[model samples]
Target: MAQQAYMTETDNQGSGHEPRGTRIRRLMSRLANRLFAGGRDGRGIWRRGMVLTALAVLVGLIMLLHAQVPNTIGNSGSLIETFLPWLGVSVPVLLVLALVRRSATALIAVLFPAIVWLNLFGGLLGDKAGTGGDLTVATHNVNADNPDPAGTARDVAASGADVVALEELKTSAVPVYEKALASTYRYHSVQGTVGLWSKYPMTGVRAVDIQLGWTRAMRATVTTPEGQVAVYVAHMPSVRVKMEAGFTARQRDKSADALGEAIADEKLTKVVLLGDLNGTMNDRALNGVTSQMRSTQGAAGSGFGFSWPASFPMARIDQILVKGIEPESSWTLPETGSDHLPVAARVSVDTSS
Candidate 1:
């Protein structure tokens, strides 16, 4: 009778919930204690996961001093720089592993990569584009196998760009693009696999030899109301990645050098270069061109403005670089049937310059 009375009183006081909750809390506490039990010896947080700690530090150093990394080994340095921004992804993975191992050392070491990544790429996360621009130009590498060439042409025309550059043009489909874009662009020129359509009058239209033994580049003077601006359209040789050959870009690099040389010779003060360079400005291989020009995307675009493999853009290979023109804003257009998404930039064109 005494035990029965005590049980009824206990159940009435808290309905037995408090004891169950307390037990669960205690169980969690025990697990935590076991996980963090050792602090001064083997199996301790400081001593565990040293490899992870080392890896984190190494990743940080690589990003911090990526330029120092040599390109001698299969142009490994260039390859790394190509996707350098993605290196930040390793930080979170290392952090998770450190937590699983309860490793304080690794936790601290992960900060190295975290900090390095933030320092390198954090600036790109914010908005830098300004308002107001006189000229809107767009570029696209419409694939040769596009199922709807006419549709692709129409999509590009819809961007309302004063100047449009199309690369990788197929001989048979040139007529389709001409007819589709004819309504929007009155003045246009096609040189080899590349073409330029302009709302303004185009003069000095001719092929630019990029040392490819054929014309894959061209230059024309677009007489915009603001003034005449030299526009260059180019398609650098494509690069391939083979297990044995690594980033086989020797051909592309040579082509880039030739193209850069051509741009450097432009007489016009205001110039706009549009193309699929097959490489990024971060890449040292394009220094011949990048050294002189300014990237509109880097100067005025929001985010990375990646414009390749239209399905999921990852890198900003398509570029709109300017000399003497000021980019007010830059952006990537909606995907068309082409493999590449069109990239456009609005810029302040001062003819007097």
Candidate 2:
């Protein structure tokens, strides 16, 4: 009897007793088996399918009308548009879940977001380096408080751009920039804080009134070997989103409207606009400008080149836009001593049109 009791105790310790973690895992396994049992059955498959379909529909809706959503909450629309490329992540995650659930319905639903995401941002996924252009133009917003004006000027001039448009020039640093770039660029024009330095002669220099009380924009005609190109350097009003106010860009919008009107009234055939517009092409607030000209990045660049906060670029506020020109290529330059990185575009003047 004693031997039998001891044997029974040993058996209980060896097999019947389970550690806390093991017990928990076993319970979870049982729960999973219960939940996933007969997963291919009608009700089980339908439930999983419905959940994935809901996810697919949600992603689709955001992709379709993300722009229509108001900026009432931290400029949510612009924020989403800024990081719009990230929306692709949802498709793969939903796909994995559908595969795990083994639901044909969910698997099919995953295709919706995948298709929508591809349609929206697929073009930006490939290499865009194809050919060179006749002219290379660059734009940079040297911060007003930039510590190295000479260095910034040197960096931009070294880019070998025939024309460079600079914005946010401070009163004290303008001379430094002028001296640094004068050796490389023979012709330069400045109006208010915005300036344009060109290797070719400049004409028709004037201040562009963006409804700002002071001058923050200018236009000049750069005479190149190929032909004459009208260039506009503009520094739009800055925008901010705060807890108290959401996407406060009233001033920037007004400035954009004024700039757009000026562009419409422009008599020149070949026109290029460069500056820190303080917004992306995706933002409807810049429709005034976007409606008039084509973004070089969209026309020729490879990916979504976000170029702001020079340390770690998150959104592209600097832009190079053109009308009546073919952009062979567009790209962002290395970071400079400014808050914004320089944006460059190589464009050929189609004088035939």
Candidate 3:
């Protein structure tokens, strides 16, 4: 009887002197057991990953209601919209986490973002390009500090674009560009930091004001075989993101408004705009310009024709937009010495219309 009493006392002492880690493990095991009850029909589906489920739901709502997000704080709405397509990345990640935790609730919540993302971007995955077009146009932001202006001109000329627009033109490099492209393009004009070269006859070329006090945009009439088209070449003011100021793009936004007004006033029925807009088509600040026009890449390009930062393109800031011209094919040109890769599009202008 004494031996039995001694053994009982030893057992009590061991329980009281258990290590902290051991005690934590025991507590966690009990909690996990309560969370995941064994059952053949997945009885504990609703009891897991409460935090993960909440996060997944929030991500889905953010994607679904992104436009409603206010820009009062640091222009967060524009920033979000600029990279809106990337928001889909969270869906697959959340799904993986849900599967690992056997969380039915989180898995179901993840579907919200998945569906919303597919609805927005699914159409972009297919090849919509046609085989024929009457005119081909291209645009490039030949970096102001490009090392080889002549070679860059030759590269764009090789694309066989009937009309080409170059932005960020340096005063010194204008002659080099003109000389290199002179052989292929007979008509050309340069105004401030932007220029346009065309195989067809060009007239009525003039600098357009975008409220920067100097010319960064221009409009010209190109007489193609089909008819006359008013082409606009613009290099919108660059935008920056700062820790103190957030997305600093008020100037760009103003310029876009002015540019939109200018386009709205054009006399010609067929219009094509090309340039480095410095913002994605999804950015709301550009609504003044985008609302009335259509993107060639969106209409005919096979993929997300991201054309900026040639080394690692993440956005299609360089664009070809149209009011009446129909896009047949769209694509990006090979990398030049400049920072941005040139974008090209083939468009059909019906003669009978």
> Which lDDT tens digits does candidate 1 get at residues 234-269?
999997888997887888889889888888889988
Spell out the clash pairs found in candidate 2: none
lDDT of each: 0.90, 0.86, 0.91
Model 2, residue 31: distance off in Å is 18
TM-score of 3: 0.87
- lDDT for 307 in candidate 3 is 89
lDDT of 3 by residue, 23-73 (tens): 899999987675455457655868777888999888778777888888777
Estimate, for each residue in 1-353, the C-alpha lDDT of model 2 and write its tens digit: 87677668866534555578977998998976664555445566456667788888888788888878787776778767766667888998988887677566787888888888888878877767548688999999999999899999999888889999999999899999999998999999889999999999999999999999999999998888888889999999998877787667888889999999998888888999999999888887888899889888888997877789889887888999999888888889888888899988889885453
* Candidate 1 colliding pairs: none
- By summed lDDT, the worst window of 10 consecutive residues in model 2 runs over 37-46
Which portions of model 3 show Cα errors greater than 4 Å? 1-43, 351-353
User: What is candidate 2's local distance difference test score?
Assistant: 0.86
